[model samples]
Target: MEWLQPTSENLIEGYDEPQGKLDIDRVESKQITTNTIISDFFVMLNCLGERTVSQLPAPDDKVYHRIMEEIAPYFERILIIKINNQIIEVSLQHVKKEALTILNNKAVHPVLDEFFHGEADKSGYNLFGQVPNRSVYKVLPHFIDPLEDPEVQQLFDFLKEMCSVTKDFGFILKPWLLSDELKQLQAIRFAAHYCQDVYLWVDNDTERIFEIQFKF
Candidate 1:
């Protein structure tokens, strides 16, 4: 084992020791097994969409049972991580589509378009209710501006009502702000009063205040 450590002088020459033999067949089998496990886990997650507290398949289910048993408690954690990644990807796509629609109808700043099209943070929670919190909302600068016009005020009021209704059930909101001024104000206001911790950012390109909500 000590001889396997390559020194700087011999590093470029490669290992001096003879190549150790490996069981290629066994390695291939393990690789296949790992792929199968991951594939099955994804399938399970897809089946669990929108439904809370899914019942695991019986231990007699062979393939699924074997995978879960092998992974044990870590299986749930991996499943959740994969699910969250999938949700974030889907949620971002949904947001881009909606933003594009909004842009087509109204003249929006180029910077705002770019900001919306670019990467967004994936940080929110799922709230349960009749409407359900499928969309993630980001509190934009317009949301907290005290001098907002009537139209802007109405939009904020609508958002506040939505937030209030979903407070008990819980919802996810991200804040993409152009300054810390609005972000700090909104965070304390929304979180303390409505129990929402909206994600915040400072970007001049960001225009609308909204959230990225997702399903499943």
Candidate 2:
């Protein structure tokens, strides 16, 4: 089926915390009355969220692309349905489409993928749930002198671009996460079973999130 933009951006917004307001079971129940395909997609997302807790190694590019392609159409379709029903503002379409493009078009650069080295250490918390807190400083500690290495500089540039894009939206990218210098940053901090100190910093916050693993 063709991908329709989602009715609610919050439902399928990328790199966001799980919705507290949204009781997935309830939403599923209600949505099933209207569209089984959308309800099924919600179920899939919920399952994916649960599976995310395993702290698995990042999927290979091909695997990642396959997953995105498989899901993108559903997200788009859901958004379109929502808009048609007058459930949300029309402005949300741009945001949702941007997300869809990221999923469908963007591939994790080899350098960025190598940042994990292995199982991503799985040691930090932020808006994207328990996924890797992929700060360049944490991931590529060796490139302390980034300017000295052209390759590292290139990677930094890519990260900065990524940071700018994510920051423009309501999400925080690892590279642009709350930094000490960006004191104006607002963040959500909480404790999790695996990590004691977790922070969720959102858009336009000029702060950096320091990985707790390093302090210890």
Candidate 3:
């Protein structure tokens, strides 16, 4: 199926408006696919006040079973918080873990693997230059230096561009890692691309407030 744009109108279509309101600003649908659609739907459910967990209506195939088994643990860690008269809940760690597991353990498509490594040191900095191993070096020096050398600047620009491309195309390449039966392994090549640390505020009565803070 073609990807669908995630809009406020689409989010509220089937749900009762009186139950909750959607903070659409937090919603983003960059790489669209059935996998992304299912993932995003769950994200929206957590964003709303839906406490129950629902399984994806996937066919009884190896791909479906593998995906479910991989994500099951994360579902167990889901936490729910009520804030400002609204309940907010989300469990993305499982998704990230699953994605990373798939990427690291399975052999990636040659094209996608090339894309990942080619852009690994795009910034031209030596941060990842010393290591010949793409996987190891690609994630090293997560932070960029401010020394401002010409070579370093070039590499940094490359890294930024590569990050953008991955965000745009990663979803398309994910299905390739699935078994022939259409079961996809959990791969997290896109994990670092969307990293954000969350903080919460709790009162004496255990009431909680959800907040997001970014790390440099």
Candidate 4:
């Protein structure tokens, strides 16, 4: 983390650890698998109905059954970590593929590209999430009480069992400006629309008010 003078783009002025660079693949291209995450912008690899046994590499039945009686069901995906001398990541797959395309193509964004696997957080060494309707939780939340849903409760137990195997693992999302502090900021304001260009309406608007929109 470092601090500097605020710019039009970054009003907050300071940043947290410039995010974790835990993998060379993420650095080169913010993609773990070459598969498509699709429009939902959710679900790690789009394994909508796939089970852990199908998605994960084969392990001993004794090891697998101990984790979950029949087979462990993921919220959608799992973070498989195998820790040795240093952390080793094993799971991060995007399940969906573009079937309509004549050419193999994929799409990504703030949503689909977003993976909250907190590999950097000590508590989140093996990231697990059950995000419903886009709500988020801490890297790790205490599951002290029994959940109402039997399947969900089972999933929680499954997550705990997975954590016991500390040897192996793995899994981000990104953002830019959100606010500004200047008094005149709101008075004379223009902000980008998400992934949309700030100067998008510049050439079209009669008032030309969008001229002040961000350029760089």
What TM-score would each prediction reach against the true structure? 0.23, 0.21, 0.20, 0.23
Candidate 2 error regions (>4 Å): 1-48, 51-71, 74-107, 110-120, 124-167, 172-216
Worst 10 residues of 4 by lDDT: 135-144
- Higher-scoring candidate on lDDT, 1 or 2: 1
Show where candidate 3 strays beyond 4 Å. 1-67, 70-90, 94-102, 111-216
What is candidate 3's lDDT per residue for 148-171, written digit by digit as tens?
234323322322333331212111
Ten-residue region with minimum lDDT total, candidate 3: 169-178
Better of 1 and 3 by lDDT: 1
State the C-alpha lDDT per candidate.
0.28, 0.26, 0.27, 0.26
Instruction: Compose the digit string of candidate 4's lDDT tens values, residues 1-216.
Output: 011122234312332322343532221112222222221222433332234222232233444433222222222234443323223333433333432231124443322222221122232221123322221111111211111434323333343344333322111222111222211121112122111122211111121111122221
What overall lDDT, based on C-alpha atoms, would model 2 receive against the true structure?
A: 0.26
What value does the lDDT take at residue 40 in candidate 1?
27
For residue 149, give model 3's deviation from the true position in Å. 42
Q: For model 1, how does the per-residue alpha-carbon lDDT over 1-216 read when each residue is reduced to its tens digit?
A: 111111222111222322343221101112122222223222322222234332222212343344343322222222311222221100000112222233356553322222233233343312222232122234333344333234333323333432232322222223343334433342333333332333321222343223332111
Clashes of 2: 17
Q: Which 10-residue window of candidate 1 scores lowest in summed lDDT?
A: 87-96
Highest lDDT among the candidates is held by which one? 1
